[model samples]
Target: MKTSTRLEQAIKKLYVAFHNNTLHPECCKQCAVGNILNNTDSWKHLSDYHGALELNYIGKVNESFGRKFNGYSPSELLKIEATFLKACGYQLPLHYKNSKPKHPTNKDVLFNGLTKVVTFLCELDGVSNVMDYTKLFEFINEKPRFQLDDVITF
Candidate 1:
């Protein structure tokens, strides 16, 4: 299968998990993605950009929760990150010196991509509209407002 196909399928799986309220790793006793999301401390790290989804962040989460590290590889982490962020129509948080992506990133493109994901999520959650769902997530709290014509380099 193509990479895009695989990603789409993964996102669908994620949607199901969310819909079922089984997104927690402990809920199903499953993999790293659920583990990370279910742990509030870990999720905060990702949300706050305290660390990337790398070894250090995992270690910190593990320490915070008193859970032993489960020895997931870097590629595994990247795969998980890609799937989760893509499901939210987001890329990995950029933490480099310039805080820019290697590829061009525009607000319209991101907004559109996010709209697709958010719309699907809304439908799954039985939310009838886009604005309603965004309000629930409070997603724009710290981000720049995305206008239809706004262009961002990252």
Candidate 2:
């Protein structure tokens, strides 16, 4: 399937990070968005607090000017990080007081975070989520129940 250049690049980076054991939920420089941005922690400046869904003043100004970091706007970056963190069992605005998984670096935990981030990225790109497997089961009797194009809407 055709995908935007930026989307493809982001997915590639995530793919490498997931397999290379570089994805760490608590580290801004090693999380999903961080890996997408080439393992940089700069994206954290987009939000006042880590794991926050809202952007800070600087992030708002950048979004106003259509500024994008690695093909993702400041707001989009914030959302991506929040989604990853939440899926990895981290409480919002992550901190010592927030609830988190007993094993943040566990492969299963990281995989869950990666799945959600990829889904969110696909949503932003207006494409089918690459990780979605339900479509494989959405057929019957050696025939398709729906057209492939219909799946893209999801």
Instruction: Kindly list the per-residue Cα lDDT of model 1 for residues 23-54, writing each as its tens digit.
Output: 43212122224443332333333333422445
Q: Which pairs of residues collide in candidate 2?
A: none
lDDT, each prediction:
0.39, 0.88
lDDT per residue (tens digit) for residues 1-154 in model 2: 6788888899889889989999898898899888989999988888889999888898888999999999999988988999999999999998999899999999999999989988999899998887886785687888877677855532
Top-scoring candidate (lDDT): 2
Runs with alpha carbons beyond 4 Å of true place in candidate 1 = 1-16, 21-40, 43-54, 57-75, 94-154
In model 1, the clashing pairs are none
